[model samples]
Target: MAASVIELSDVSVVRDGNTILDSLSWQVADDQRWVILGPNGAGKTTLLQVASASIHPSHGSAEVLGSKLGAVDVFELRPRIGFASTAMARRIPRDETVLNSVMTAAYSVTGRWNEEYENLDVRRAQRVLAEWKLSALEDRKFGDLSDGEQKRVQIARAVMTDPELLLLDEPAASLDLGAREELLQLLSGYASAPSAPAIVMVTHHVEEIPAGFTHALLLADGAITAQGPVDEVITAENLGETFGLNLSVTRENGRFAARAA
Candidate 1:
């Protein structure tokens, strides 16, 4: 319901004298899809944790969907945001049916319980599975699917509730070239849809960024190196600064490619 889907002003996260995020200020409007790009230890995932309300910032303010992080009941706020990550994937039962893996999101629980689910929930899961091309795998155990298929299922499960904001952490990680392209195509199509939820995906590789993502935030050493429209923030100089290397970057047909120059 808020015009600003996510806003972080002077946000900092510290633990045991280590600062994971350093005085970060960022905002995401309702219409934007953002890619988080940074090298390892750049605090990309830390930033997502703050935005998704999994943790409060040590200082400054965070607001998502009109709810301020520290002031709101996170349990109530959690379901309004959809998050998918490797840590979350580990929580799902390996033998869980693909259909129930998604259907369980409606109740905010990890596994299907003895409580009866509504017919509409099942229908919604079916539709989401179809959207991710997981309809055929609905009867299969989650563990039986390949890495790429499991990632798609996770994305589908995250969107099952139609969250106002969707957060994906390395949705394309560890995939073969073909699988990576497949997931990227699906994400690009989802992002291009005007009706899709505002999205933020964290990835270590520039090539993993989907075509329709509109904005980017580049972080390095726990601070922002660049943040703006995708084309501007992804230039060679900016990327070089972000990654501590001399780099050459190119974009064509809404996709990006980069290498050390």
Candidate 2:
């Protein structure tokens, strides 16, 4: 059996006297690619934080990469997990070059300082850039890139460390049709690779799900509506209930689309 990359048991998070997550339990295996669907404020980001070992659950136990959250030093555990999100992106210096932006991830820093890097690190960063199709833009400033290009850079940076678990928050949000499709294509190819790490991505739209994702988890009101194989969990009935509206869902060629019915 594949080992569990993430395990949450009756986990709940409360902030400022309000419940952000309520009794959520989930397990992700090392071989699975998962997509999390939810409306705004459904605690999707909070869930990812728990998985990334950035935040401990307010209640119950949480485990990531085989270490219990409260028992482990997150500073040490964090390097083993790759995380990309809008919040993380804002920390990068606008003047940082694309190659530096990715190489800095080796030290888990947002920007390059006086950190010493070896020849092997530069080669690894260059290889990752090529894999994400950003080799040509390696010398370009991160702030000068297009939205699609910036998004790819973020993912490339996340994987630069060769983490065991990867967490992405709304990676395809705000992209145009062409940009979204291009990003999805790259994500699909990465997720399909045999050596790829366990992945979990959060998105508001099912249409943004990539082709090779194997599992789905739908969230509403800080609770899980459904979860399992992608084919079974992303149905019209499940989506309708999750979004509080009648939705028509379709799946063809391993991609998903949803609309109001």
- Which candidate ranks first by lDDT, i.e. highest? 2
What shift in Å separates residue 134 of candidate 1 from its native position after superposition?
0.5
- Please write out the lDDT profile of model 2 over residues 12-90, one tens digit for every residue: 9999999999999999999999999999999999999999998899999999999999999999999999999988888
TM-score per candidate: 0.98, 0.99
Error of 2 at 46 (Å): 0.5
Predicted candidate 1 versus true structure: per-residue lDDT over 73-149, tens digit per residue: 99999999999999888888999999999999998877887968989999999999999999999999998999999
Report residue 58 deviation for candidate 2 (angstroms).
0.6
Q: At residue 30, what lDDT does model 2 achieve?
A: 98
After superposition, the stretches of candidate 1 with alpha carbons farther than 4 Å from their true spots are: none
Q: Where in model 2 is the C-alpha error above 4 Å?
A: none
RMSD after Cα superposition, model 2: 0.6
Displacement of residue 154 (Cα, Å) in model 2 is 0.5
